[model samples]
Target: MNWLLVIVGAMVGAPLRYLTDRTVQSRHDSLFPWGTFTVNMAGCLVLGLLTGAAAAGAASSHLQLLLGTGLCGALTTYSTFSYETLRLAKEGAGRYAVANVAGSVAVGLAAAFAGAWLAG
Candidate 1:
């Protein structure tokens, strides 16, 4: 049941991520991967909140698995982020690549922390 929930959550989260990426890309002309960044940040925030809620006994274990393992795992794409950064670097957008990596890591972490704190 837990695994099923996770799978369902992933199905929903992955499509949502893809759609969001496409929407942002279509709307923006910047070379920077704003879509990926936004999704990751949002995922971090949600994961933090879910974790905090779970820890506080406000959420059930199934909810945790569904949100954290499925939704967050799908939404927060480290692989995509890494690939984009590497592609940027390879394409000679070294500054953008570095900024992407640095900003995502720094801000994502902060967002997670903030979400956790707020949820708590």
Candidate 2:
């Protein structure tokens, strides 16, 4: 049952992630990896919300597995982020690479905190 839920959730999340990345990336001319950053931050915020809901006893373990483990896990891609950052650095866009790492961390944390606060 849990595995099924995970697969179901991933079915939605994976396509959504790809579409979102393409939509966001299409708007930017730079190689700052805005798409990956956006997805990561969004995933963080969602996980925070799920965590808060769990803490508040509003979300069941099954729900957590489906949404958090399944959806968020599929929607966010650490591999892509790492690859893009390294690509940027290799292409001499070292500043952009650094910015991507720092910005993603700061913004992702803040977004997660905000989501948790809102859920709480």
lDDT of 2 by residue, 21-90 (tens): 9999999998789888989999999999998888899999999999998999999999999999999999
Tens digits of per-residue lDDT for model 1, 10-110: 99899999999889878889888999998999999998898788778898989988888898889889999999999999999999999999999899999
TM-score for candidate 1: 0.96
Clashes of 2: 0
- Candidate 1 lDDT at 6 equals 95
TM of each candidate vs. truth: 0.96, 0.98
- Per-candidate RMSD vs. true structure? 0.9, 0.6
Please tell me which predicted candidate would have the highest TM-score against the true structure.
2
Highest lDDT scorer = 2
- Among all windows of 10 consecutive residues in model 2, the one with the lowest summed lDDT is 110-119
- Compared with the true structure, the alpha-carbon lDDT of candidate 2 equals 0.93
